[model samples]
Target chain A: MDETIRTILAEHGHLPVEVAKIGDEDDLYQAGMTSHASVNVMLALEDEFDVEFPEVMLRKSTFESVAAIRVALGELTGS
Target chain B: MSDAGLFRDELVAAGLLVLTGTDGIYGRSSVYEDIVAAVDGLAVGAALAEGAVSYRFPPVMPRQVFEQTGYLSSFPDLMGSVSTFTGNNADHRKLMDVAQAGGDWTALLQAAGANLCPAACHPLYPTLAGTLPEGGRRFDVAGWCYRHEPSVDPARMQAFRMHELVYVGDAAGATEHRDRWLQLGVDVLASLGLEVQTVVANDPFFGRVGRILADNQRAETLKFEIVTPISSAEHPTAIGSSNCHLDHFGEPFGIETADGGVAHSCCFGFGLDRITLALLRTHGMDPGDWPAAARDRLWA
Candidate 1:
């Protein structure tokens, strides 16, 4: 699951650094992921996970890290 | 009806504005124009002293260029695309029949391949599609900006003059420009005796996805508006705003910084019509009754 998330980030995050370099708890926005890129990343994550992020999940902190994304995905997918 | 609606009615009764049968559209009187011009002068003067060049664009821009600005996806509710009667003779006859019957004739019209200028600085981005100079570029861009909102609120005009200082270059320059102009906005409004409060604000992004966008924007502290009591003290209207669009325009417009990176952009815009109204509300409806200090900042 983590590897899949990393793959999606690599394809859509548009971060200055590679996903392999980003740890599970690393701050994605701090690593240069823009708001534009963040939207794309969110869409791609939804596509990959087959889950929909709720209105309450629409925040900077929800997508702040790989661990955070996993937790959000877990809640939606009932992992 | 809001207090602004009553105030708008008063302005119309006072011969300051001509009603055009539209909620947010009106014709400005010479006196109204004078005050708007004075406000424009004050804003332009601030940017000019900092060596900002003056650039002007028409109220309409090519739809192709406007599509790249992400305005359609971001603020689709406010976006206005120009359409015209491009059909053949048969379609024209149909349109005429509909118009004569007081029916919807606009459905027959096709895209005019143009869009109403959403903001003064939007049309300026495409013109800066190359590498900028060492320090960057700054301009005082002005145009008749259009938003599709029709309201009785006098401050929320459908068509209004947006006079802004737009800066494009490195991230530092972009952020600094927004910061500086935000302070100037507070000072400028207060200097005119308007009780101003500068606060973090967000654009009215549309749709479910737009909720996330708005949240992200507010979280970034990228936009600030100088609010004043035009309608009421509790619900002050924003007369001016300073925004930092960090590489949002540069990446799409192909604008590069002097140091060979995606350029960042920022804008400090004054809603001229709203500012004029704020002045009227703050000092009396009559410009002649305005204080000497406020008059000197504008008329002088």
Candidate 2:
């Protein structure tokens, strides 16, 4: 899971050091998640898991942190 | 490239010039006949698979249909009606005919029957109501839509062509259905080498209830939009959108699934014109220099 998170962050996260220091519950937008960056995050998530994120989960809150996104993926995969 | 850049480059590549209109109707100097044909072909090929049929809708619809759907009350500013004019002799004859036979010709046209179809989806809804299949159905619709906007910016137009991919099905099915198509939209654009941002967005409908519903539904149902950084970075142009109307249209339209329950509906609409512009912006207008992968994917 840490490796997966690290890969996702590397691929999608624009803020390198901040993403490393922050917890999963922190807001991505507050940490500078532009619309384009968030989309990159979504694409990375889809490419990593090979599962489509439900239309209902494409909100501002879902990309808040590594942990939040992990939680979302867990729910989607029922892990 | 920005809208201005795309506007200029596409014109040159296609042997066009930007001509301003006296009536303030902005138009391309290029002959769009080929462009329209190319877009239609690309859209049809990419969107529809084998065995999918095509359907065309009328340019206008009855006013009652929109009223029932709550669009008239919600978006009255954008609504247009076909108004009738009766002159002196003709008006007198009609008045006498009404007095004698108790029927007025003016009332017929004035009845809730002359509203303009502001968006392509308006006419599709009434036709789809109570006539949908037991499971679900997909529709490929294209039409000329009207809006009462006061913007001269090329991005925001008073009249436009809309190509929509609509899906009607059960609740979870509908959400998943739109999600899948939304992903397809992203993939298609990426293949074109356009850097798009799929963000959470609300519908353009205006009203207190509409705003509330948009916020609540966008949060819970996840209405994602694939937008390009055009016009401004803060407010980018929403080139594509995925909507999951969970039973909102179904209950009103009497659309149901095989399980005898109202089904949720979803749609993924792509503004074809915006996509063309985005492509031109991303990869310059020179077809020769355009990305090989993008051209192959789109031309495929």
Using TM-score as the measure, the top candidate is: 1
User: Compared with the true structure, what per-residue lDDT tens digits does model 1 show for residues A1-79?
Assistant: 7888889889998988988999899999999887767888888988888888989998888889999999999899889
Residue pairs in steric clash, candidate 1?
A: none
Q: lDDT per residue, candidate 1, B219-251, as tens digits?
A: 999999999888767899999999999988998
CAPRI-wise, candidate 1 is medium
Among these predictions, the greatest DockQ belongs to 1
The backbone clash count of each candidate, in order, is 0, 1
Error of 2 at B48 (Å): 2.5
Pairs that collide in candidate 2 are: A56-B221
Candidate 2 wrong stretches, greater than 4 Å: A1-79, B1-25, B28-33, B86-112, B131-134, B285-289
Model 1 chain B poorest ten-residue lDDT run: B205-214
Alpha-carbon DockQ of candidate 2 = 0.02
Across residues B52-75, which tens digit of lDDT does each residue of candidate 2 receive?
A: 345667767777776766666557
Q: Which 10-residue window in model 2 chain B sums to the lowest lDDT?
A: B16-25
